[model samples]
Target chain A: MDVLSLPFIQHAILAGILASVACGIIGSLVVVNRSVFLAGGIAHAAYGGVGLAFFLSLPPLPCIIGFSLFMALIMAAFTVERRHRMDTFIGVLWAVGMATGIILIDLSPGYNVDLMSFLFGSILTVPVSDIKVMAAVDILIIGAMCGFYKEFLAMSYDMEFARVRGLPVRLFHFLFMALVALAVVMTIRVVGLILVMALFTIAPYLTERFSASLAGMMVTSTIANIVFVFTGLWISYRYNLTSGATIILVAALFFMIFIILSRFASCPRKP
Target chain B: MAPGGDQQTTVLPEGQSRAGEVPDVEIENCSFAFNSVPVLRDVNIRIYHGDFVAIIGPNGGGKTTLVKLMLGLLKPQKGRVRLLGSDPAKSCRRVGYMPQYSTGEKGFPITVMDVALLGRLGLTGIGCRFTREDREAALGALRLVGMEKYMNKRIGDLSGGQIQRTLLARALISNPEVLFLDEPMASIDIDGQSMLFDLLGELNKKMTILFVTHDVGLLSRYIKSIICVNETVYFHHEPKISPDMASLMMGTGEKCPVEMVAHGIPHRVLGRHERD
Candidate 1:
């Protein structure tokens, strides 16, 4: 099939929609929970998965997903379990996670893994099977987030305060971690895990500045994310720019524009 | 959920002739040290139900540490800290806790109502949905703290006193049998602190309160009993503001030689009442 053929292009376009849904939904939660950095931590940790897949001759996606989820859970647990002096531990884990990925890749005898694809991204050849997986993950994320929307929102703002009020903060923390892990795994394909953090944070952050409610922020983030991804795709296609780089550029541009608009607009009314 | 007097009746011990066991809280041989430095020594103390107990001492006197132990956030190196009749962790659901100087805690973009509603989140269900009863309970707590009107406002936008009130609501909403406030009035204006003191005095009707502060004078007007800590433990001293107590609470002659000898432990005056 020709590179520019309509069906291939249409498939890529469909993949973009799925990618936006996954990124936007997860990004909204990540932004609110202040776990954007955790995404970055997980992304670097995910390199271990890719390296492991290469070394064991396993399918890259599942291996990568398993490792990424494992890393995400470990990181999440550190935050909850190591309540005191957690920053010290998380900093160490971030370094360790990244180091593990780089070292493992180095040890994967004679296999020349394309490190650039993970660092930047190469969405041009995303498989239909991967797209289907992303769609399923998207459905799960959106459904579960909506199901526990109030609880997640309540906990994100204040865990101890919520716990005192009887909010089952620990259970919600675990549930939110599960969603984050699943979302991070799904997002790896679209922007590559390396650049996923930027998308996960930037979209919802822009939306949150203007949104009065958590639900509104999620909706605004999804719409803005679709725009961001599509605009990135179009720019990369037209100008032959890097798809991942182009998406970040588009997201950043929108963030700036939103800030400028809010500046000119009158102060937001208190709810 | 206003608990009547005798909230700690369930926590009373079965053994006979234990002098240190209070009806509300009991710490037996409690010793805590962070890195060789002792924050709290082998401390034994008790607080009875319906008693307004004030823990007054200098900075680094382990007042906060004592509160954390009572909340079960920290474990003692030597002894046990009990709340109501169970261990602090097991009885956490029955205890209301408020940390002081809440104005300094940067609130993310969350509505005040939702923040107040947090107190009811876990107790309502597995997923912690807010039922009508829960909503009513949260609203009542807010009203009690004079922050009902600001319930819909963003937490970050609140004034110092308002933020303190929000925290108070978060603590009180659960209607815990025992309430602990660590410097709850620290950041508020003097007027606000005085008002809060009055509010707390009224609150003593049903629940026992343990307020941790460096200055006992500010709290002396209402508290029924006092406990002082300067690495060691002092218990159930007479709740009167003598010149020595006034100086300790004012933190002016904070380290003066005349220290109130209580519970057979000598307290360093400066250590008992830190100025800041």
Candidate 2:
């Protein structure tokens, strides 16, 4: 109860809710489209933005957002025509982006910040300004998704069919990549870059067991993420453990439990 | 039919003929290629309203390419493609397409209803709710394919035939003027295939249809005309295949010019070709 009264803790809670909004919506798309690898590359490549922000002494939120968006566009363009060879290009970008971040950080004058927080999240340290940024991004993501819902669903289900129906499949793809970039950047504050994909993927994957449609999956995933974030926060506060790691650990535990239960439930007669 | 089968363009003067009489689709001197390799060259086709046409050719013979050009999924390097008297891409909302089964992802998490509702996406740009009308249309399409009971069912849970039917419902939900189907028979059983062809035949009374498949023998009975596509195209206005033409189509003789079949072909052999 005392922790609830603390402003930092309250900010952390707000950040968690906003992160769940993205994790629920964009994460469902990422899982359904089976673009987990592409999302992972973008998430990791986002570190370049963090490095750039540090080097430029700019506000990390917009700087990282811009950098991640630029990287996502490049990835989208590369994968458009030569999809069979996409993995090679994605891998190259992943490495190069990370390398650029590390070199930039090293070159930055007297920028000796603790890198672990950026890598693994520092939700308790999320400032009010960052929370505002997260909220704006949440609004942006939700609004775009609502406006492009059918187009996204059609493209996800059958891209060629969407293309034939006069849907701008390529344009939607680039826009979706940009959204993914924004989601990754906003989420980095709550779950950190290294573990963000887990949060992005796990909720939707777990919800798929019961959800019949993409919208259902998103709703169920949002609720599940809320549960995970709150429970993980309480447990981390009690044990004085790392909040991001604890949240992911809680989700992983639920994932394992569901797997075991579903396996048995599906084949109850099996030995 | 043109007396000489070299090039035929029957575009009616603007505002001369009634809308119903205008050809549903027209392609003139269309050429397409992937990479440096040419897939289709100098192809021309006209599909009138209410025509049930089958596009049949050997594997890699550009059947799919011609369909793509017509649907505006791919641009022809040099040609004009018109659908419903406009650019195919611009009038695409009036076109329904069922791509090959292999293109659909198996084990994807989606319901039959949601898949069918994809047809209604063109009715409005994003943000609007799925209206009651949209739902009813989707349901009606599902009923057409006899999968209304499975509308709520997950697509992955259905059998191959059931999935194909669901896809048909998706394409039909829009109530388009023309339907383009690519190898839709690949996964269905013979009975299901028969029923599907029957459904397409019934639909042809109101809509033009362009079916792309290599299994011409199975489809020739229902289709009213055939378009044979290789690197080039040969448009056959009639489905009644002469015995000699049938033999040539089956690769029994040296390749005769497709134009020869329109006029009674002399005994010219066709180059041996393999069926897909």
Candidate 3:
């Protein structure tokens, strides 16, 4: 059977595409808002959600998504709270969040809740319900994005200035994080919690490296995300590889190649 | 000049009487420390309606720190700052602040108009819909800065001068009672500098203005007053009115010395910072 012909392959490809849409749209905001580092911390913090879902004997997707949002809100709130002491506060919270998840998992008996799947991800196992949830997440993320495009644009470019303009910056920031929460929860299946940050940052970074405007960067990022996800999936499935790790490796390779090429390109050209 | 105070009466238009008289800024005995180190010492100043003031000091002289206090971006260890008779920290929406443009990064993708529209954020509620009037006001602010044509242009695409103008527009769009500009003319051409001064002059006719700049001599030409802040704040009442006192007012004490750098301080960066 052709790669696209198999039901699992098709499901994997669809999942990758959906994750990219959510990741790209959300990642575009992350890049502009300079929240990539925060995204990294928040994604890892979602491990507790995975453990909670398995421990509760609840449906993993909904539970994980719910837990991710909870952790994301806390991270978002703390980032603001510790704005002056960001690095230190975020670090402590990061450690605490992951530890809580691990302990909870250890406490839960008998259920071998493939916690490894969360570390590297298992997109091939994405259920129909998970796909629906991802679709809802994509819609919500995109809708919010479109609605606040102007405000988001204002906030991203210059926050203090935005406040001067009478935009509810604090509220917008909260909303932005809410959407990011949605994106993080959605991608938990594709890249797992640990490497999901890459999916959110790399596609946008690539687009930024090439594009001239925010709109250009966003469109290019979405396209790049789709391409990268599919290409990564194709290589992994063809070789019977650990799909999430393979995908991340593919992204990293692209990131390295582009960074090097751009450095040289950005260097002073011969007079 | 006001009788007891050696400063000239801050000029305002006919209808702009001090009636309903909103004091744009009032900082009294404000003190601030950074990580246990004193940055500002017993700072006190009161900026009234339509007063165009410039804040000048050395790099570590706490000029920017003073702006942060006035705008309520930072709080004082002791003392109080009142903007329009309200706490600066709490009344964030009503205050317009243009941060120093020199240290800004360009890689962040945003349009010129987009940056300007940030000023409008204070006007909307949580998820409030912006009416047509809001958009028009934003556009008008952009038009005033002569950046109407480049509304959709990416902020990074603009030159240093244009970025400054864009920031100015952003500050203006909020329709603030008082506008605080930090180093508004940095990294721009002479023309841009003059354009900014001219625009600020126009703005001052309507609202109270407080601008921060490292350049001393030029600031006095336009603003009615100057507050020289180092580790402590000192008021120079009617700076333009008493042109000769620039050096004397700047040289408050033996505390702050003039730093001889390539981009030197315009005045003696004086005053003692209170140690924590």
lDDT of 2 at A249: 96
Model 3 CA lDDT for position A201: 89
lDDT of 3 by residue, B173-249 (tens): 87877888888877777666777778888888998888887666455345777776668666755553232233333
CAPRI tier for the interface of model 1: acceptable
Q: What TM-score against the true fold does each predicted structure earn?
A: 0.83, 0.85, 0.84
Off by over 4 Å in 3: A1-3, A111-113, A209-216, A260-271, B1-20, B89-95, B102-104, B124-140, B240-276
**If ranked by DockQ, best first, what sequence of candidates would result?**
2, 3, 1
DockQ per candidate, 2 decimals: 0.36, 0.46, 0.43
Q: What's the residue-level lDDT of B196 in candidate 1?
A: 84
**Residue lDDT tens for model 1, A8-107:** 5666677777877777777777787777777677776777887787677778778877887787777777786436676666667667867777777778
Better of 1 and 2 by lDDT: 2
lDDT tens digits, residue span B1-276, model 2 = 222223323222121223556678888888888876898888777778877877776677788888888888888898899988898879988989888786346656788998898888878565566788999999999999999999888887788778888888989999889999888887787777778888888898889888887765455356777677667676766554323234334442243233332222221222132221
Pick out the ten consecutive residues of candidate 2 chain B with the lowest summed lDDT: B262-271
What does DockQ come to for candidate 2? Answer: 0.46
Minimum summed lDDT over a 10-residue window in model 1 chain A is located at A159-168
lDDT of 3 by residue, A96-211 (tens): 77887888888888758477877788898887778888888888887776677767777777666565445666777777777887788788789788788888888898887456
The lDDT per prediction is 0.71, 0.80, 0.73
Chain B TM-scores per candidate, in order, are 0.78, 0.80, 0.79
